[model samples]
Target: MKTRLVTASVLLAALGVTAAPPPVSAASLPPVSASSPPAPAGEHGWVTSTLRHMSLEQKVGQLFATYVYGADATAPSAADRAANRAAFGVETPAEVIERYHLGGVCYFSWSHNLNDPGQIATLSNGLQRAALDDGSKGRVPLLISTDQEQGVVLRMPAPAAQFPGAMALGAARSAGAARTAARVTGRELAAVGIRQPYAPIADVNVDPANPVIGVRSFGADPALVAGLTAAQVLGFQDDAGVTAVAKHFPGHGDTGTDSHTNLPVIDHTREEWDRVDAPPFRRAIAAGVESIMTAHIVVPALDPSGDPATLSPRILTGVLRGELGFRGVVVTDALNMAAVRQRYGDERVPVLALKAGADQLLMPPDLRLARDAVLRAVADGELTERRVDESVRRILTMKYRQGLARAPFVDVDEAVRTVGAPAHLAAVTRVTDATLTAVRNDAGLLPLPRADRSVLVTGWDTAAFAPVATVAASFTARGARTTARPATLPSDQAIADTAAAAAAHDLTVVLVNKAWDTEVGDPRASQQRLVAALLATGRPVVVVAVRDPYDIAHLPGVDTYLATYSYTRAAMDTLVRALHGELSPRGRLPVTIPTADGTGVLHPYGHGLTW
Candidate 1:
């Protein structure tokens, strides 16, 4: 079957489906040593041959990586496909391939349950089969990519091991640990047929008020973030056979806004940008990263035009390509995002992004319009055919670099077994244990007495406390009684009730969960009030940040604080054990927790306590 696909592709190419135009004046294309040890470079020799055989429409199709939704890996049913088509403004996967000759597809857990390894592999294989069977010139394998960043923004469902996010890795203060995390993440993703992971966020999370970046970044330090980012790239590429995309280039770390909600402007001067935002990317490019995802941000210092980096030639081409010398494929962070969509509209976004130097259009709201718009731009000479070929070359080169042309299929059963394999699960457990930073332990109150002390656990909702119950059970295992209840925020009565309940307990443990770093001023006002009530009752109140560590800085009055960095099962369990003296808290703060007065990070980076 493989031979047939290759033979058909070669024969079709020989028939000159699209005659090769003069080679675009190669203005020093990124160098690749065909003799390099990696399999990607070994296949570099085939890029041009494959490109020559592709039709003009096929070339354009390769630029757009469309979004798809279905029950399994195969294309959705006629009815279901219609709905997805209507939503994304495209036809069935078959029509998408036959018409657009798509370059790739991005998977979201919303449509495809990426947590199920067998199911994900099945979906990936089915998509590849469609692409291979589409009867195109090269039978180019789809570049299957996903947002598997592992910490706070994990897209894969369980039993994919959830590691401590980037900040936790920073807390561990080990570049080797970051590399291992990325390697495991990439290996698991590759096992499930994901060839690329949009991860190792290169953002140097400098602002504590940053709503989106919070712990998703490694830490507040540029050099530290750079080392970890470089390590992640090596881990993903060398160890996992998956390409790693260092994201939000020029930095999304300092902004108090989320690009998903609106466009953010980074007002840093070029010199400051070099000092803070550009290091991780520079390290990534130097480490031979094959792809970079653009930030939906405007750097007025870099580009006078207010266009975000995703569509700005000055940022993407000038800084990323020219200044940093990144020769790899540049992909945009989902075009459907309001940062780009509300401003340019669907048709124009992809066209402008490509013109600005992006090689792949990720999840554009309208696939057909984006593709056709690019085709028209080429025809109307708004974009030269040479520019299109440059992108196609880069896209094709990445497929080769990923070795997709050589081995595009996977073993579904193997993927199922390997994705959340025991060793990988254990690796994350260790990371979780390592990242439990103890910010404040009033009066050496930690290693909470396992016997005779009454304990109460409360959270914003019962569901949020579901994992905390495991922590409570750890107390029960040690012969202590425990009770838990929900304290939904913004209701003064609920806060008062929660306070009343905590006052009766010998020790009160309150769980706080705020996943994204979106800055809505005083997000913890209710929690603060509840904690204040607990404090007023003269009982020892221990605050646990189950997700974002920065939550601690908001409640300075809380004397006992702990950060788990994630709410994964292992993390929750580790926190329980740490409280009982079974596991010592080792993780330091990855980012600063600014004082309530916003004077400084109450506990700066690398701050932690142990008993």
Candidate 2:
């Protein structure tokens, strides 16, 4: 297939602009080389030398990492066809790989059958093999990376083990547990032949109204986030040798907007960054993280150019590399994201990103446009040949360090065995058990009536409270009448019903899931209203905040407020055990919750309870 080239002039015209463009100057163009070299014998040694040998077109190809989707290899959708025609003018992965010798690929789970682990392994392995086979220097193993941040951002489903979100881990506040989780997550990806995991989100969640990064972040405290990030990085890279990328740096946790849909402008200054956002990244880099993924948010304080961090030289080269001294590969968040593509024309982005010191231009919407632009820039002496080599050297160095320079091998069966193995499950249990804090227990309503009395259970996603049902079952077995209201209750109705239900039962257990709406505060108001109603019943009510501790202070009427810090199955099971007096709540609140509406004394980090 012939590649299509969309010039900046054409792009501007399409955008309804008729401004005269400046002449393309030689100093503004990428430099080209006349001679090509032979491949070296060492794994990535050949990669570095071959990178040096590349002409302008080949060098440009090295900068792009395009997005590929769908389960069937050949089924192209309308969007895919348009992307192929406009970007690289290629419809198939084989063609794109062969035409530009593209550097890497960022994929979605839609491309493979995730429900079947073996199939996922086969598909990803095949994609990697295909990239290596099409290389000019005889099989350059492409860096296969993905956004497997777990929880809400999880890429793999079913068979793949899903751990609690970063917020849950932060609430647990156990670096040891975070490390264990990372190792398990890394081993799982390594099994599927995925070399890099775009994870260990270093964003500190300060904005409760943050539409995107609420539960995805560790917490609001920068210190705790930095410590946990280092631990997670160590777990993934050191424990499993899987390349873990500390992402959305210099931090996406504080932003209220989602970069996937719109560009978010961070107003913090360099001093603010150094104090709040830069610590976790510095710690991660110091811990030897292999890669750093730049965010799309525009921080004017960091870069006066008014560009997203992904395309900002001040942020990528000046801040991350020069100031913070991160020597590893610097990868961009998906360039195709609306934050970039909707503003800067697709063709001009890759070249600018390369010049900005980005090693990888991830998920460019139009790979062909990016390829041709980089090639044209190189031909025109806009981007230097030395610059291309510099990035290629870094890439090669990382590969060599990862042992991918020697021999690349992935053990599929072993990966499946290690993903959610007994040890990993134990770690999850330990962390959840340690983190569940009883913020308020005025009447000592917990350790609910031993199987000798009647009890009732209720909440959101009521089915999730099955463990509570099991507890009730055990109580019934012990000659107690345990009735469970399986109905899904809106917060207020559930509370009211609990009160009415309490009239019949000796105790009422309200299972609460703190639902956060980005536009509103007090996600627990309904629960609070319900708890008030239930308290009027004169029944012992045990409240569990399944996600955040922010709701605990709002509803103190309940005898006990247990913060599970998450809604994962393991967490639920642990909560059930704790309620039945089978297990003690050993964990503490990793973050503080404000006492009064805006008092800011909820429960400071490191607040917990003993048996």
By TM-score, who's the top model here?
1
List TM-scores for all candidates, in order: 0.89, 0.80
lDDT at residue 466 of model 2 (Cα atoms)? 58
Tens digits of per-residue lDDT, candidate 1, 162-269, equal 787888887777767777788788877877678888988999777656767877888777777888888888878877768889998878977766889898888778
Sequence-dependent TM-score of model 1: 0.89
- Which ranges in model 1 have alpha carbons more than 4 Å from their true place? 1-42, 75-79, 88-95, 461-465, 488-490, 515-524
- Would you list the C-alpha lDDT of every candidate in the order shown? 0.75, 0.66
Model 2 lDDT on a 0 to 1 scale: 0.66
Query: How many residue pairs collide in each prediction?
Result: 4, 18
